[model samples]
Each structure stands twice: as structure tokens, then as C-alpha cells.
Target: MKQHITRFRLRSVSAVAALLFAAHTAWAVDPFTVRDIRVEGLQRVEPGTIFASLPFRIGDTYNDEKGSGAIRSLFALGLFKDVRLEVSGDVLTVIVEERPTVADVDFAGTKEFDKDTLKKAMRDVGLTEGRPFDKALADRAEQELKRQYINRSLYGAEVVTTVTPIERNRVNLTFTVSEGEPAKIKDIRIVGNSAFSESTLKGLFDLDTGGWLSWYTKSDRYSRAKLNADLETLRSYYLARGYLEFRVDSTQVAISPNKQDITITVNVTEGQRYVVSGVKLEGNYLGRDDEFKSLVKIRPGEPYNADQVAETTKAFTDYFSNFGFAFARVEAVPEVDRANNRVAFVLQADPARRAYVRRIMVSGNNRTRDEVIRREFRQFESSWYDGDKIKLSRDRVDRLGYFSEVNIDTQDVPGSPDQVDLVINVTEKPTGSLQVGAGFSSAEKIALTFGIKQENVFGSGNYLGLDINTSKYNRAIVLSTTNPYFTQDGISRTIDVYHRSTRPYQDQGGDYRLLTSGASMRFGVPFSETDTVFFGAGGERTEIKPGTNIPGAYLKYAEQVGYVTYSLPLTIGWSRDSRDSALVPNRGRYQRFNSELGVAGDARYVRGNYQFQQYVPLNKKFTLSFNTELGAGKGLGGRPFPIFKNFYSGGLGSVRGFDQGTLGPRDVTGSSIGGTKKFTLNTELTAPFPGAGNDRTLRLFAFVDVGNVFGENQPIRAGEMRVSTGVGLSWISPVGPLRLAFAQPVRKFAGDRIQKLQFQIGTSF
Candidate 1:
């Protein structure tokens, strides 16, 4: 016969007295052997759990001491609400009240966090579906929800949890959260500063009182983490300016009684400025002291700058690592003379030992193949560790554009002092995109573009793309593919097939179209890590459609060429790019030389273009960029250069502040017949958008542009070039890269067409 009895804690006065009486009376009766152990009141826990928790077995002796220990052990499991042991005729009966099971967790009024996110967070802290539920755990969950909102600057947020008992030993939990408005920073004040003005010091901080752009930057909101970072910036500003003894004494953050406003006050000590006296080397340098000394970035007579000191130390450490000293240590010991206001530094170095790489491991590349990444590594396994090559390998993998993050870590092999393992980790990003977009312009009204590209198809380092543009005036279709490892020797092969139709005067007059179709195959041979040479051949047929608005130059050409032309184009090009970032590059040099020769078919001509671009970072927030392009073409074998192959320069991609493709010689009826020679120069000063909190996605650029196209018979003249100065904005938004510019032409001829505003979206600059 089975009997069920739920356990109840000995909390009542009578129950406690009875437990004491039983304990006192237990000495009167001799300890008896346990015949059998029976467990009751268990719903979810197995009987074996109780058997394993009990101190006495069925064949062992049972006493009050054993019963107490058994109860304590069962209660410690946290799976039971109450546990008790009772003895009746030597058969010990164990009773347990199982904790209520969580049937379903629900949330109400929670807008900031996803429902599943909250459920998962609770699961991590021992509260989940079908898990034991307790009042203490529920209280902790409520506090955790509030803490999340608090971190987001919602000081007045509240979370209330309700537990409702249900049938089948289950309880439903509901967490209702009221996320209030974020607290705003009302005021920021700096005190105890004599070297710099309050405004100047406050300008160095990211957190501040609300500004016109605060809604976007969120700097007006109070965030402890952001505040901490700003404090560090303030300290660095002083340290870099020769205040070697600067100290941030205290910071006070106050919140209003309503919890809607915050105020911050910073106290700092700006000690006397100092100058560097000298620098010396101290510790063992492996006999390369002179080589290491040349790497110092500090000047002896310069003001004592902490940044320079830190840079000098880091350079020393990196130089040591380049010689297989992976565990090198370098420290800058400063000797300060307060009376003379000068500081001297003694660089101490310790090259612990030399090591070689034992194994090369790659991880975190879920989509990209291993070979695609390994081929970029110049450092080989089982070779002496070369820090410079390892860094280069890491950068090469990062430049592939398939990974968002790439990291190299050296791990010491166990029991091997002179051996280490190199681990390369990469986090993959989405490599395929299907983009469809439409933009509006006063001239075209609406232009639609579509593109589908896969940079790493099926985890192979290959590229396939299709492009289609459907603008009433310009329409085209292109299919292209590239195999980055064409011959498994780092050479790349690309094939392209394209059909295009262009109307030169559709915006002004009738639709006179030029239709062209062609295909090309190119191979890129990498001469160096940063340089490539491309050579290819292509065939094309061009047809000129009859129309009233056709330019005089085109009409004359069509009559001689019979309204059709054919050409076999040979192309050779070389390019070198060392840009730190393809988007928003701060420092780099990019140059390209391209030549096209029409060798076979109805046209014989040669055209070449050379372009160079350089970017220099003037400071942390500003970059100076310069670009120049030159193009020239001439007929060969007594045949004129193809009219459709002429070069054009103006507008957004060239000299702005003028009508697109209108800077060259004009044909009869005032149509821009593109010329055979093109030249352009562009310069820009770019910086992050103001009040954007270091977000590189948005930037502002001021530029100067100069260029013009020259006809086939016209001599290149610098006096005829157009010049413009303008300001532009570049934003890398979720949709695409968007550019907008406002320009004014400084010099223009009487007949020059002027366009002051230009914009384009859905393209990378």
C-alpha cells in the first residue's frame, strides 16, 4: 500500500516543539536497523535521488543524527521546497515537497528588449521552462531586468514580476517592465584646472550637455561607460600636452530627484609642464642597440609627451619581437627633475628567449575555405617567429573583405620553451548581396539600378556578379565572374560580357541611341603584395541609331562608318593600392595605368589613362586626399579614334560644379561630343561629421576640383580648364553609400553649362 504525504517545514511553534521532543526522546529507544526506506510526496524528483541523499541504508542503523543529516542533504539540492524524515517501526519515511515548475514565462510592456532575449537571459540564471521556480530567484530576475534598463540610461525604469499558481504543479511567471525615458545630461563642469580653459577641456570630452545633433549622437544621454571613456580622453589630452603630472582627482555625477536630468563635475590637477632632457638604453639588447635606438620617436629637447614615450616603448617591443623574441619586455623608466622641470627616460629591454612557430591554426571562418586564408599568410609553420610577417598575414586576411574581424594570437606550447603555436581567427561577414535601388534627378527623373554579386561563392574565393541599369537614357546589362586563384599561383582571371545602350541628348531633345555589345577575358598577375598587372582582349560592335537630335560629329561619323563599327580591343593595365581601408581610408596611395588598343576590326586606335590618389592623415580627425587623372587617345594606321571611345570629364566623378560630360568641345546644335583627351585634378579635406561621437559612417569633405576635356585636334591648354570649390557629405547608411555635394564654379566660359547640386546613392565611393 502506498501513502502520500507532503512535507511541511518545522516553522510553527508546535512543530518545532514536537521536533525537539522527538530528538530528546530518541535516546530512550535503541537504534534499530532500517528494514526499508520509503519516499513520499515526490512528483518530479526520482526516488533514487532520495536514496542517494539518505545517510542510512535499508540494512543500516537509523537515528535522529542520521535523519537530520539526510534532511539537510536533500534540502541542499534546491530541487525541493521542504524535506522531512519520519520513523515508524524502523522503516524510515522520507517526504519532499517538489518546487513549482515554470510552465511559461511572459513579459508585458517591455519594448526595449526582445521577448526571446529576456527568456534566454532568465534561463542562464537558473530560471527556465520546466525548471524549479523559487521566490528568491524570481526577485533576482526582476532586479536584473531593471539593471538592463538602467544601463541604457533609463534611471526611472521599473520591473514587476507576478507569479500565478497553475494546475499540474506548475506556475506561470510574468515580468512587466516600464522602461522610462532616458536621463539626459543637463550640465558638465570642470574644476581645478589652470593650464587650459574650461571650454577647451570640455571640448575634448564626448559626453556633454544637449546640442542640436544630440539626438543622433546620443552624447547628451548619461552613460557610465561613455563617461568613463571621456574621462580617459581628457586625461590623455593633458598628458600628451606635456603635463606629465596631471591627475584626475575626483568626478561627481548627480541625478535630479525626478531622475530625468544628470549633472557631471570633474576635478583635475594640472601640474607644471616639463621637457625631455635625454634618453638612454639600459637592459640587454642582444647586440642590436643601435638598430633599436633609431626607432625612437621622441626628441630630447621636446616637451615631455606621454604619447611619445609610450610610442617609443611600443616600437622597442615590436622590434624585439621581430627577432623571434616573442616574450620580450620593454619598460620606460623616467627620471624627473622637478627643479629643472625636465625628464629623462631610460628604456630597459629584456629579450627573454627566442621561439619558433610549431603549428599554424585557423578558426572562425565558417564560410570561407581554409586555403583562401592560409595562402595570404607569409609566415610559415615550424619557422622562426617573425612578428612583422605575422602582422602582414593578418592584414592580408582582413583585406579580403569577407571577414569583419581578423586576429592573430601566439600560444606557448606546453613543455616547449622555444616553441609556440600561431592561431589565426577570423569572423566572417555576409559576402553576397542583391541590391536594387532607384534614384531621382531633375535631369533623368528616375534611374533604376540592380546588382547581384557573390564575393565568396560556396566558400570558394571567387566572384560572380550581374549588373543591370534601366534609366530611360542609359541602359545596360553586364555579367562578370572572377576566379581569384585562377592557376593556384595567386593569379586572378576575370571574364565579362556586356550590352549597353546610351542616349547622349535624351534629357534635352530626341532619343538618338548608341548600342554596343562586347565580351572580354582578363587575367591579373600579382607582381607584389600591393601591385597587379592586368591584360585582356575584347571584341565589340557598335551601332548608331538614326535620330533628329544626333550631334553633327556623330552624324558625320555615321555616314563614313555606315552607322556601324567593329573593333577588337586589347587592354593592359597596372594598379597598386595600399589603402588602410577601402571605405574612409585615412592614409594610403593608389595608382593605376590603363591602356586600350584597337588592333583588329574597322577601327585602329590607342588610348591610355593614368590616375593617382594619395591620402594623408593630418591628425586624428582630419585626412587630406589628392587625386589626378590624365587620359589621351590617338588614331593609328590612318584611322580616327572611335567616336564612342572618346573620353569625358565633368560632374561628380570629375570636375564638379559643371554639367556632367559638358566640359569638353561641343558639336553643332550645342551637344557635348566627348573629346579624345581628358585631364582632371581633385583635392579634399575630409573629417568626421561634427557631433557624431567618432562614428566613421558619416563624414564631411571640402574639395577643390580642376579639369577639362580637349578635342582630337585641340592642343591641351591649362587656361581652358574649369575650376570649382565645393563641400560634400558621404554617409555609409544601411541602404548604401550616399554622396551629396554643393558646388560653385570659380571659372566658366560664357556657353558652359552649370550644375550646382549633385548626388548619387547606392554606390561605394
Candidate 2:
């Protein structure tokens, strides 16, 4: 009986201990239905937002797991700095400390960037007005400002952030930035290089030590990006010279204690010179090995050239892409023979799959119409992918003068390996301009010009312009418009109405005038992508006003054909322009041929002019251009060409050495009497402004000009042509395009007039 009692007691104790454990577990994770939910400490955020973020709702089971998840969801909103949950009975309460809102953002002592720009930058990083503000974000903003200064080589720049608490639980951030003087490269040294001289290697770098033009070029500025670019150039130089194992081991940029000067050191290892032992193909060549082999630029028994290898591979890839292989891959693998100091290149090509363009998409053209860009594309939707056609289409769009940037991206369909989409993205630029210009010349004194021009009028891909000029010598009023897609067959229509009165600027033919008023309509038919043919007709009424100092040519015309004359002129022209840039051309050719016939008028004559220009890039910094123009006019039937139609040379647009319109034959009063035949040739070498880096808006050029005008009976003679040589500056300033030249006549006659300096502002030639 005693043993049974003790066993019963032990069993009772075990049962009590197990019950306690179960009760503790139940208290820890007991699920209860939420009877009420309430949020506290909400200023800007809505209560509904908090309720939406909660993982548990009223009447939902609430446990430790759900409570933790609810806290996490609330914190992830990034609107609260502190979040806490409390439970009383079946009610759950959430308490949050909302982040301080940014009331305002301002900058002080920031001359490099404007306040609006800096604010925009901050806004981009989620630190804008009315947004959540915190120390972490403010710290990031400070770092971003520092980074911008560093990019400008401002090593000593300092930024201080001041957070001022304002009303309504908001804070205003003030970034006080002090941009220090940019660190200039005082010295650049290359060590451990033996194959090339230090000076020779240094010439390959775009960055350099301080020079006379350093202030403008900023090449002396110490920038991490520029240093990396220079290092890559050095690598390319060595690699292209057959240094197969060349490498830039280390580069050290040290700044002075004052942070105003910097020194760069580059250490390199050029292992050995290599020769190309052989070249071979290792993959399928679309069953045209010979054709593919012909594209290889690498030659056996020649020094190994990395450029050649890259070119050969790129050529293979492009060739494959031309044949509908949109995802082609071509890689050149080199097998090095260390003992022989030679390498063999094996080109591997993979034509992954044939694909066609499923659709051509255009985007980012906010102002321009979709059809305007589509019309320029040579590659159509559903066509086989052709790399050449795609490139041409991109170029055509770039030449439209409507966009600042044009890019083409090919996207492959997820489920269709044989289908792709071409996305043409364009960044639109301002195509309209209102120009008001005033320029002074020695002869014309001061000339004022005003014009309003719109190349893409209202996104319709049309052109409209109105010009008014008030100059003593030349005055004009004109209106013009063009429809680029007149007939939808790529033919353009242009209409122009103009009235002008001309008098000699230098001779001041006091009150004497040749008035010309006319209207014309023209159509430009595209013969090819780069060629166009234009034909038009117009009627002109010319009047010779008699007065003191009248030009002898005009007097003679008035005596023969009366003071007033009318003519119906027919015009036809052809032009081909493939220049890389319309404003600052650096390559390609521009050729034009234009002719005018006075078929039914008081004056019967035919006039024709031909001009050609070619630009060749000599190097990264220099461009060589050549221009030639020829014009001739003759009487038709038995009548002489109108004196008003005479060609005038010797000006900024012609021969720059002599006075404006003062070249060729002269009358008794020593006034220029322009002739019917004209020819001119201009050659120029253009380069970026000293210290201007790669800015093409400002440039300097040295030119050689030769031209002369001849009478109807005079013969064309090289000896009779005037020659000039000078240096000039071309600047595309905010006002307009300006050109200034100081020319010296190299060849001239005793009767020739000289004007050494000439300039034109707000003009296009």
C-alpha cells in the first residue's frame, strides 16, 4: 500500500509539470481574433495607408508570427523611422514615428551648379521637397555633391549640410558647397618602358601636364576617368605594335599637399614583339569559307596587330548580320608560341539563328511625329535583319536635324529566337529659333537682322521661317515654308516670297537701288537617300532706281531695257550631301548643281552654277576641307544677260582678300561692275580652339582662297584670279554663327581693292 501511494504522487507531479509547460506555450503563441486596430502618430501619411500595410485585419487571427510580419510590413514602407506594436486584450495598436519631411532644399556658395539643378539632383535621389528626409539620405546627398566636384578635378572642395527644422515637423536642407581650384597635372611620368620613347608614348595620351593652352583644354586637370582613358590608350599603343603580353601594371596619381597640383606615374610591362604565324577559321562560315576568308585583314608573316584581329572579327560578325543572322558571334582566339615569339589567330563564328524584324518601334520623340522618323528608316518591319540597312536608317534619322541623339536597339522576342524588334530611340532637340542680331562692319557700319525659324513646325515635319533685315546696303523681307512629305512619295514642296533692295555698301550709291521682288514654288524629289533633285518656277520684277552714285552696270541696264523689267525664271537643281554634321562638318562630300533660265521675260538668258565641297578628317583634332564653285551666264536668243543678273565675288562668301563685291572688272568711277562668269576655290584646315578640348562649336582654321569674276568676252585665266591666305575663327555662339577672318592678298593687280579684315554674324553659307 505504501509503494502504490508514492507512485501515485510521482505521476501527479509529472502531470502538473506537463500541464504548466503546455500553458506557457499556449500563452506565448495563442491566436486571438483582432477586435480593433488603431494607428498612432500619423502626420502626413493617411491612416488607410497604415491599415493597408498591416498583415493582420480586424477579426483575423493574430499570433506572434503574424505580429512580427505586421511590424516588418510597416517598416518596409520607408515612411516611418520607428515602429512599435502593442496589444491590449484583443485590440492591436501600431505606433510609428514618421520621418521628417523635406520642406525645402537650397544651395549656398555653389557657383558650379545652379540651385534648380542641384535641387533636381537631390530630387532624383529621393530628397526632394515634401518627401521623407533622414540623415542617411542627407549623407548620400553630401557625397553626391562631393563626387560632382571630384569629377571636375576640384580636390579641395568641401560641402557642409545644415538641416533646419521648420514648422509642421519638416526640415530644410542647405548644402553649402565651396568648390576649390581644380587640381592641375604638374607632371606626367612613364617608367619601365623600353620599346618606345617616353615623349612618343606621352603623345598618345589625351591628358597631359600643364601647357600654354591648359587653361582652356583642361587636359591638365587630374581626373580619374581621363587617367583610365590614357591608360587604355597606352595599352592599345603597345598591343597594336605586336606586344602580345603588354600590360599596364600600375598607375599612381599623387597630389600635392596644397591640392593644387598632381603628378601621374604609369608602370608597364611590354613582354615581347609577336608576329602573325598564320590565320585560320574554326567554325561554320555559312558554307562560304572563301567569301569569309576574303574579309580577313590579318596576314601571315606580318607583325601581330590587335586592331587587325578585332577588325577581322567585327567584319565577320557584321557580314553574318547582313545575312539575317542578328545574333551572330565572332571571336578571334590567339594561340601564342612563346618560344617562337609568334601567334596564330583562329576566328570562330557562330551564326546563332536567322531572324526577321517583327516590328520597328520608335520612342522618346516627344515633339516629333512617329511617321517623321519612320519615313527615314530604310529597314522595314518584317524584313530580314540587315546591319547595313539598319546603320543607314540610323544615319538618315540623325541627318534630320531634329534630334540631339539617335540610337537603335534590337530586342529579341522571349519565345521567338527567329524574331526581333528594332527600337529607334531619339532625343528631341529645339528645332525652332528666334534670332535678333546686330553686327558692325567697317563698310556697312551696323546691320540688324531678325528672323524666326521653325524646322519641325508643330511636330508636322515642316519648315517655316520669316526674316526681316534692316541694313543700309542690303535690306530684305522674306517668308518661306516647306512640306517635307508633300506627296507621301518622299517629295518635298517649298514656297518662298521675298523682296530685297541692294546698294553698294562701300561706294554708298546714295539712294541708288536695284529692287527685286519675287515668289517661287519648288519641289524636291529624292532620287536616293543622299541625293535630291529640285525644280521650280518663279516671276521677278526688277527696278533700277536712278540717283546719285548709281552703279554704271545698273545705269547701262536702265538705258537699254528701261528702268523696270520683268522676268519669268525657271529653276532646276540637284544636290547630294553626305556630311556627318550640318553645322560642323568633319567628313564626306557635298555637291550641288543649279541652273536658271529666263524663258519668258524682258531679259532672255540662262545661268548655271556648280559647287562641290569635300571634308577629310586628318586626325582626331584636325580636318581638311576643300570647296570649289563655278558660275556662268549667257544671253539666250539675241539678247544680252541682264546686268542685274551679274555675279559678284570678293567678299566673306567668296575671295576674302579684297573689299566686298570689289573683285573683277571695274567701271570708270572705280566702282565694281560684276561680270557674268565666276569661279572660286577655297581650301581650309580646321581644328578645335586651343584649350577648348573637343568642342566643335568654337574652331580655328587657316584657309587659302582663290577666285575671280570675268566679263562675258573675257577668257578664264588662272593668272587673272586673285589669291588670298589667312587665318579665321568660326564660332556658333548663342546669338548665331559668326565668322571672322584677317586675310592678306597674296596675288593682286594694281587696280585691285584690298580689305584685310572681314566678319559676318548671324549668317549661313
Top TM-score: which candidate number? 2
Model 2: per-residue Cα lDDT at residue 96: 85
Q: Per-residue lDDT of 542-628 in model 1, one digit per residue for the tens?
A: 999888778888888777666888999999999999887777788998999999999998878999999998999997778999999
- Look at candidate 2 and tell me the lDDT of residue 747: 94
Our model 2 lands, by Cα RMSD against the true structure, at 6.8
Model 2 clash pairs are: 216-691, 217-691
The estimated TM-scores of all candidates read 0.89, 0.90
Each model's C-alpha lDDT? 0.85, 0.86
For all predictions, the C-alpha RMSD in Å is: 4.0, 6.8
Q: How many clashes (backbone N, Cα, C below 3 Å) per candidate?
A: 0, 2
Native-vs-model 2 lDDT?
A: 0.86
Model 1: how far residue 359 lies from native, Å:
1.6
With a 3 Å backbone cut-off (N, CA, C), the pairs that clash in candidate 1 are none
Q: Please write out the lDDT profile of model 2 over residues 609-712, one tens digit for every residue.
A: 99999999997779999999999999888887888788889868889878988888777777787889999999999988876666687899999999999999
